[model samples]
Target: MEFTITNVILLFAVLLVIAVITTKFSSRLGLPSLVFFIAVGMALNHYIYFDNAYLAQLFGILALIVILFEGGLTTKWCHVRKVLLPSASLATIGVIATTLIIGFFATYILELEWLEGMMFGAIVGSTDAAAIFAVLGNKNIRTKLKATLEAESGSNDPMAIFLTVSFITLIQSHEMNFLSLVLSFFWEMGIGLVLGLLWGKVAVWMINKINLDSSGLYPVLSLALAVLTYSTVSFVHASGLLAVYVMAIFVGNSDLTYRTSIIRFNEGFGWMMHILMFILLGLLVFPNQLVSIAWQGMALALLLMFVARPIGVFLSMMFMKYSFQEKVFISWAGLRGAVPIVLATFPLIAGLEHSQMIFNVVFFVVFTSALFQGATISVLAQKLGFTGETKAPAPYSLELVSIGRTNSEIVEMTIEEGSAVVGKELRELELPEDTLITAIIRGNKIVTPRGTTSLQAGDILYVLVTKAQRETAKQIILEG
Candidate 1:
């Protein structure tokens, strides 16, 4: 129980191990890991004694940067391209609509000042990328719907962050300038976008040109560049989180050396940040305070899920071409996670009259969202007929490690029944130029393919092909 460095480290390590172990139970119960992580933090709050709003906010922002960057890195441009416009609209206009709706409702429900109500709204406005990513990780949703949700979650934070800061200023200073606010929003977003794209290109070039002695250092280099990107953008009064996400998108999609390794490392690192952020947030809560605000928090959470989120989503995509079912699913999937809790710290730091109340409500809202919305995402997807066929990962894997940019890479394709390639020899199939079937996985055996080797149904093929011919090779193996 002593507050020493060794004790702190030991406590942290033990907590992490327990959190990791809880994932198995969480997954089995179809709940997001956040629930358990937060539970663990709350259970230890008595012994740990962590109530620093400033420190929690700082760590939350850092954790969010890594989490958002990882989300961007894993986002495929091809999938997001078609849904970009709708997603952007949701991220911006939808967020504003949601905030206003919730703010007005909160003003009447909680009898708070107008600005304070809006501040509460802004704090919980954006759908959390961390929560969305975690819940949808295994869900087989349609491509357009999935991409829209993912892209919106990844990009929506900037708008929410801007609004929260602006409202806090208005609340504190008791002044409002419409023109100035509009200009500031554009400046923050525009500068963040430009810087993200620019830094992404520069980072990719550096990674390829530097050619580090150790492959492990590639991840470190990326990690440093990400932090630098955020810090530099923030220094200029722009949205650092947006910049980080955009930069990661470029780095992830580029043909850089050790790209896979870098991505995998960030994925793991991002998970660690998620665990720490949620637990730290959980530690900040006092059970007695939560009980006092429990009724209001539950009412607000219900309003967000049933009323505000749906209205926001439908209105944002009014001109877009999405089915009613798709829209409904999207609305249901707006789960809140670390961002709202992080933003809640802002009010606390400002020492607002109702700041503690706001934090408790936000914390409760996030918990309810993770527990209810997170748990039912898959069932809703299926009920709405938006679920796609889920594929199990390949038992055997291959990575093409390189020290520099390479055109050729390994692609995996599963040979389903009724394929043209079935019962055909490798030499018999007219494969794409420069494409080679490196290995065939049949059941538990790894077959070293030869010219005479015959392909069969239920075979997983690893083909080495250049990016230019990648599609053609895929068509041949998968379709014919």
Candidate 2:
């Protein structure tokens, strides 16, 4: 196969088509699409050779920025607020605990030195936001549980990243300065948080004030800002991934022009990054190399899954209100994904003596975690009685597009049985000033709402209201 520009593009298109088709079937089979993506990449390696650790690491970092930002952008502040403290605890303390436990096990079981074991542990310690978001896609789990998992996964990468970098530095220098380590940790986290919030506000202001000529350009603007935020934060020696995620949350929650379009664009782009990163990573792995470490990899993975993860979760949430089953489920959901594999490449790039061995082990661990844990998450939720009823998506849709800043936006809500406004006409509900019911969806029909349109159970309402009046309007219609 000649690797000309046209031939390369043709190959890329074919891979994407295969990936999309594989995702559709993976959903039906209750498996994560990442598995198939990696399979595709590994299959391609037979014809096209690729093994550049530095390039893979660079691409992985970029993909993570988009993936993390998208996760934060779509997260609802209302849902995350209640679980914020617990999630933070899990992301920081829980990650540390998991690392230490796994590190100890690796030293004895895997017969590695203490530092090497800790480095290996740090590489795989945190739950992957990409895996969590992909696997838990509208699974109807308890709201708080889902929020905790999502928030923790989205935020925990900083701690793991910090630990991995610190260990690698220490290994290279053969020096252990505890005070410097502590200070560095604080510096990275503090700067990342401060800059994330500040940059997010600035980004939101830019989006609303610039008023781009074309609606399509709004998403492009957002994409540019996201990359800018990550790079800017990273240049200051801070956690760029953390900064990007925080900035995205701010932008996503704010009222701005084309907010919906921006989010949708990032969501689609994030999926593309996921597929590309996984496939590229798959191409880097050698099946024969993985087989050599199979026993050690399986042992460490089991230890992390059965022992380290459960202890970490329980300790982190001991003072919280989660039930025992919820805690167990949270432990089970500590899925490893692209992050660990990407982190593994760090060692290789650093030229560590056992870097290849570490990469292979980490890859195997992530593969096992994603396959076993990702596949059975829903079934476990059912058994634990944590599943909740999810409203079916409306067949009809409504979107609000603005070329300039607007305080008012569209909100969608479903009417449940015995709602206060049920059996009442739209005009009779006494909605807040300037509130307008745009459309009422009943069964298969989209009804343009009017004074004479009576609300009924199972109706989906799309209303336009100012940000300040949103809660008041919800109270009138939903709790009436």
Candidate 3:
């Protein structure tokens, strides 16, 4: 049957509708949305054979950029700053350790060639940020632990990508020395860092300085900047993914105009990308091929989930003051998702020897991970005493709009059990001149707060304050 544009549109629309429905039920089923979308693609592939590794790899790269951009944009700086050191160590040194351990397993146990083993290690080393964000973001995990996981997942992709590319190059060229490869890695990382930082500052500056007539256009501007950040870094032979993530972190944390709007838009966009990328990756796979490697793949996946990942986490975070339960949760939270499958496409695209084998193995590993680890992460967190009741979004919302360079934001706080605001009258607690308590909600009723009105636990308060005053306000409310 010949495919036409009309037919394509109809088919895509149907698939998307199916995806939307699957997503609605995903959380209830204890499955990741990628699992459903991928299953749909695999089902479709039975009737329509679509095996274009290069195209799949391209789309995966693009999807990763969007996913990481959104990850960065949504990350709260206050939380990230607290765990930055440990998270950075995990993203960098943790990735290397995971690769070596997994590589050794693949080489000695699986009897794969060293280069192929290394490639496999690199492909699946990093926990997928999209997967981590999707799974843990819904859970009521401790803020610091969640931040650390998200930051590691968001940042480690660059290291894994670098190692994968280097291994692929090593196999393909066979002439590049270890010293040369090391230099190349550093070069990519350093350039990406410089470009990302510069572009992030520039993007914040641009967003603040240029006010679009319509607030709707701000999302577009932000997205364009994000794309530019990735592309500019890539053009200079740097890590484009890293650049986009870093750029988004800077811009998202800054007090740019339409910051809230931009974040909301990207959240939607990121989900779309996730669905599309997973479907494409699923279509690229041959389920029959996965069958042959199923046992080996499961072994590798188990090895990664139970052994290498735990070592990586424990070693990277050993010096930190995290509790044993927290460390265990961190170790178990290394859920693989589309990134490994996506990176699998790299070897295929590079035309490396045993590339198909690598792809199929990676596919099985990712499936195992998403099925086992992803499904049980929240439960494990709860069991390990790392989780609490998930916080509900505020019943209502308010925000202070910025016209230009203002850093003010509408901040929301819940009156915790021991919060200083819990028993105080509004008049007793001194706040900055720029800050104001817009409204308070207790249970289902809105309390019109007066100077004499006493605050109580469980009340939700929304306050407007400059960026500089946000921390101070939180302290006063929480610790007064």
Candidate 4:
């Protein structure tokens, strides 16, 4: 069939529908929807010409900005704070370790140059944000572990990006010596950190104080802020990716009007970008070429999942209070997704030696990760006793809002099994003055709290609290 405008539109509509259905069945099948997305892209490759790595890189960069922004916007600062130091170590040191270990193996076994091997390692280094977010949403992992995994996945992209770009420069000119590389790392990360923190505050202030005339324009304004942060930071030779994540987190946690709407918008937008990005990358691959790299791909994937990742996790968390089982879970949770494939585009655009080989190997590793790790994560959690009864979705809707450092705020939370708030009477919980449990919904029943009312494991509490008591209320409920 010859291509036409109508046909293209219909094809896109079909793919969108398939994307939704793929997500609906993803958890049931123990497969991340990413597999289905990439499969679609591969299927379409025969019908279209999408072998342009340059174009793919541009689109990938934009999609990643959106993904990281949404990640920051949705993450709670309190949870991030708990895992901040350890997760930061993993994002920075863990990445370097993974890259060096994998790079050494690739250099020895594959007979590649040291720099080329490192490039391949750096390309596949990070745990993908899109994959982790999608898979974890369906699991019942504990709060701290989940937060650490999320924080690591969300923040580690910059390290991989730095390594990839640095190696590409070295492979091209061979002039970027060790001292220059170290200096570049500090220059990029230092600028990124400062700009991200500074702009995050500015973005939050703008969102809260701008008070757009139409509610619809608020999300648009937020989107603009994200793009502006990334582009402006990148132009100054800093890590724009890091800036987006930091800015999103700050704005997400701030007291802004219509915050929920902004979050909802970004979630939907991020999903669309994920779908499009994966499909496009898939379209760029030639399955026939993948056959030649099959054995090498499998070997590298196994070593990554079994050896290198565990080493990185154990070393990174050495001084932390994680148990053996928790370390094992984190090691197994290093599922690669689109990030590596997108990074592969860097080498391809750089026109370096072995670039195509690197791309093919990365595609295969991502496939294995999605098929193996993505499928087994939930089961592994259960095996290690890290999972509890999955929280059921809230049956009713609620929204909380306050303005300008006011003491009044609304909080909705599910009382997990074994949480401190569970099995305690409202009076015994000893909530702060002016803090009220407005209502408790258990299963399908709604109970107005009495002094003697006892909270259950599955109880969903609608709390109205003053700012002074917000942190205290959260500590009480989530302490379990």
Predicted structure with the largest lDDT when compared to the true one: 1
Query: Tens digits of per-residue lDDT for model 1 on 1-480?
Result: 787999889988998899888887777677789999999889888777889999999999999989988888889999989999999999999999999999988887777999999988999999976666566666677889988998999899999999999999999999899999999999999999999999999999888667456667888899889999999999999999999999999988886666677888998999899999989999999977999888889999999999999999999999999989899999999999888999999999999998998999999998998899988987888888887777567577677443234456666678999988899888887887888888889997899999999999999888887666767888888888
lDDT of 2: 0.87
- Candidate with more favorable, higher TM-score: 2 or 3: 2
Ranking under lDDT, best-scoring first? 1, 2, 4, 3
lDDT score, residue 3, model 2?
92
For all the candidates, what are their Cα RMSDs to the real structure? 4.6, 3.9, 4.7, 5.5
Task: List runs of model 3 lying over 4 Å from the truth.
Answer: 108-110, 397-480
Q: Can you give the TM-score per candidate against the true fold?
A: 0.87, 0.89, 0.85, 0.85
Q: Relative to the true structure, how large is the alpha-carbon lDDT of every model? A: 0.88, 0.87, 0.83, 0.86
| lDDT of candidate 3 over 184-288, digit per residue (tens) | 889888899889989999998887667465656778888888899998899989999888888889888885656777888898988888898998988988889
Tell me which residue pairs clash in candidate 2.
Answer: 420-480
Task: At residue 339, give the lDDT of candidate 3.
Answer: 77
Q: Count the backbone clashes (under 3 Å) in each candidate.
A: 0, 1, 0, 2
